[model samples]
Target: MPTIPSNIVVYNLITKRLFSTSTSKNMNYVEKVRLLDYWKIQDSSLQNEFPRSHLVLMVDRRLLVTKDTPDVKMVEHSYGDLKQLLGEYGLQFDLSNSCLLDALPADNDMIPLFGTSIEAADPPEDSPISKSDVLKQLGNSLGGRFTDIRMAMLTMQEERQRNLLAKFQTLTKWAATYRRCPKCAAALKMRTSKSGAECVTCQKVYYPTFSPVSITLITDPTNEHALLVRHRGSAGGVFTAVAGFAHSGESMAECARREIAEEVGIEVDLIQSLDMSQPWPMPDSSLMIAHVAIAKMDQKISVCPDELETAQWFSRQQVRQALETTLSDPQLKKLPRTLDDRQTLHYIPPAGAIAHQMIRRWVDGKIDFHNSRI
Candidate 1:
């Protein structure tokens, strides 16, 4: 058994303790949702509970979700049903790779959710099932279709389900991508209840990887305006807070400062951290850390042409408008080009995104940089 990193261990302990308590006033949706708690169950008991537990299947990275309005629900299957379906599809349900993702709330029966993935079945030449036929047949049988995970995340009404899908996708992607150990090209087996994997030859355990990204909303000295930038290939008239991945051993705050300088050629001091961290799974798994940076003085708007199309400050009202637009229509992709005009309307990220939360907090005065850091 490979030793888990001490920092990760400490983080898990602290978060588990905090979430297990009743003090949920300030906790975010992700924090409020109950993650995997399989350590509480014995292996023998886990098997007994599996048949009754709800199964969330991810076929080729898409989530199985029922078509509905306002709230999208993940299609749940029994373990026996799952086994039978996989057998029909020429696939196997590996118990070792079945990951417990989340537990429903007390009012919802507190049923445990087991997430497992099955590759698209490549049927035999003589078989009637085609390459893409599995998805259609499974959808017909389950009364749901395989939905794009991103679309499912956006339309999901319940925050708990959204968080569960994010976790499930991240874990599933990690397992699928890293089949062999880095040190030795040996087959890896699921370990720690599929939360991690261990190399068969080296006995080294690999944990899920989440790259840390610093997303900061920069405010001027007056705190009346916020700085947002648009990448070259980004949607028209859409701008978002500065974001960059932290380099090795670099603090998140420093990463924010460096990104600000590199993208917009401005210097900013960290105001404070916000309670807006999110686990994003697109492009790659990332832990988005939110913060506020204040430009102590007037700064030039020298845009890094290689990095950004434009960088400019917008009034609180503008930011508010963009947020409202996002709320009214999250699917709105095209906006009138106005990155040059600081007074005009511009859009921010969707409400589910941490960047959107950061901007909203700044506008709502929740992120008061005027107050001294306690």
Candidate 2:
């Protein structure tokens, strides 16, 4: 399995956990929502403009793909690659009952073929345009990537198959509710023909949700080592750099120091900024603000047990080897092993976590791995 992108972010504002289809096979109910990526689901205009190739969902939160047997059309490569993609991330998915091939209606010529990644996105709002330009914009938003789309098709574990109906119904209700005006008493409606919502009375528009956050790796004087901390209750198991949320009416740098103080109990200094960001989704809206900061005191360290267990400083050399795939998962023998604090890198974030992306940047110098601040 390709290293399941230890900190890859699929969408900045939303998140999905990575679990093997084998381990979670028994779950049903709300857990099944994992099957849907609400970030990319389309509206009515989307339906007329780009015929949906298929609707994939989990029957029992076990990895099932469902499609109307009669709705099959264009010859599609069986969705086997999706399985490989999941596996590389150290995750599992079931494909035994998945729809091997499916198609779309002929009139739906505007519909696009599926592939490995998100293809269409709303174009930047700053461009000047013409008719062809407008059409191209719409195409790019829906056409997505033309090939290598990794999808599991319609497959699921079975016990939760009946529950999917309720889940679909819930989504339909939310779709209708989302179209309404939250501020005004006026009834809201979906433009489905375009990119947002319309208020029937006030002519207001509401777009999809996107949230922003800030994350950083803080280091201290002498550049001998950087601030490393363990999460609360990690039992000195997992280790990671300091990071925190960027708050309202505050700058990213301010958030960096505040989070470091709150987590590691040290004052930050001589902070230099890095222009790398990742859209992290943990089931809510968030954009990762990745940066590097300096601390005044390198050796005087104390950790907050409620937020962090113990704090240490690791040299760049030790970090490079510790993060190596072959030797990455190290054992923690004492509460203070290296710095008289027993801590190991135990708590790795989600499959597409932002912290993971920042580490890669420090190592690979490939800011393009993420879409923002590259």
Candidate 3:
């Protein structure tokens, strides 16, 4: 039994989008230095100061799983170079095994991860390059540079998240513990990133935030209402926004139209994207893309008991009140959250999931709350 919705953990604090992990920005000190041509060749002197963090080794980067670790160092890399490794040791990146972690603290910017093999460097007992030195090196490597760094300070003037106490529980048998590479079936090596997961195996990558799929917010113009469907396994006949996966060669808006037709027998016209996002962790993983759509020129309503148990239209007020929040439609009814059941764990979306997030955006002005174009 997990307190977290499946693999998802409710954020302990409310801050920026990088709400879970501190974004890599406003470094009181962030610099870049040339990888001292020779230092790039050694390591005997490297293990202690920057000893490979076991946790970091297992997973490239981490999102403050325990809130606080007195001694934690942060690194930022907008652009990096493998040239030093190439020039110094004649070692090339196993391009097939490298990855980039770019977790967003906000909508546009993200933190990045840059890595190379520990086996490549020459051992040396000297101070590591300064952030500016490294920045300089990075600038030089990319045929340019920037030593000054800027970032969002909403974390400082407002409130720094209270670091929670640390606890460790081994989910050795948890299938979610491992991920699959899109290119190959091999197990993925989870690394830290400003974005999301890093796969060291196939080199194919994934971000904590990925693609978004959407649901149709269909309505009955005559009745001034919308429709919702109850899936068979939902909570106590708990009803929710109608949704499903988008097919290939489909747009978020288009997916919304299709899912509505298949699940509840409705073909919509005037469709528009509301918002796009990823599902929470507890129940499952999905990039929720939300859309609002209406019948082309007339009323439309039909049902397919095969895909859903019941599909009916609800007034705007019904949806607003049921959500508990302006934009949410909680899964008051849900299936067992088990580690072993594929449909239960893998197929299901995270509870209080991103699906709600997209809707929330719709409720707000971020998405066209009154329009039908995404």
TM-score of each: 0.76, 0.48, 0.42
List lDDT for all candidates, in order.
Answer: 0.73, 0.44, 0.38
Residue 336 in model 1: lDDT: 65
Order candidates by lDDT, high to low.
1, 2, 3
Q: Best-fitting candidate, measured by lDDT?
A: 1
- List candidate 3 stretches off by more than 4 Å: 1-25, 28-211, 281-284, 296-302, 324-351, 354-374
Error of 3 at 111 (Å): 12
Residues 1-374, model 3: lDDT tens digits: 13124322222112222322433343112111111111111122122212221121111112212113322222222222344423543434431232221122323222323332222234244747554454344334433333111111101111111110000101111223447766677766553221234456656655443234576566554425656666765543345577777788987777777777777776775776654443322223345566666653244556676766666665555554545532232222333355233122111121334444443443343444454432
What are the per-residue Cα lDDT tens digits for candidate 2 across 134-247? Answer: 433322333221111111111122213312322332233334347558888687665332224567888676754435566767655555455667777544445667766777
**Which pairs of residues have clashing backbones in candidate 1?**
none
Alpha-carbon deviation at 42 in model 2, angstroms: 10
Better of 2 and 3 by TM-score: 2
lDDT per residue as tens, model 1, 1-374: 12556765566667667755634354456664433443322244356556667788888778888865556878888778878877875777765556777654443234457888877756778987676676778776767888888777656667677787888888877877778999999998755345677788988878889899988888887888888888777667668898878889778888888878888998886556776787778768888889888895476778788978787788888888888887787755556656454324456766666777788787888788667565
Residue 220, model 3: Cα distance from true site in angstroms: 2.4
Top TM-score prediction, candidate number = 1
* Model 2 local distance difference test score: 0.44
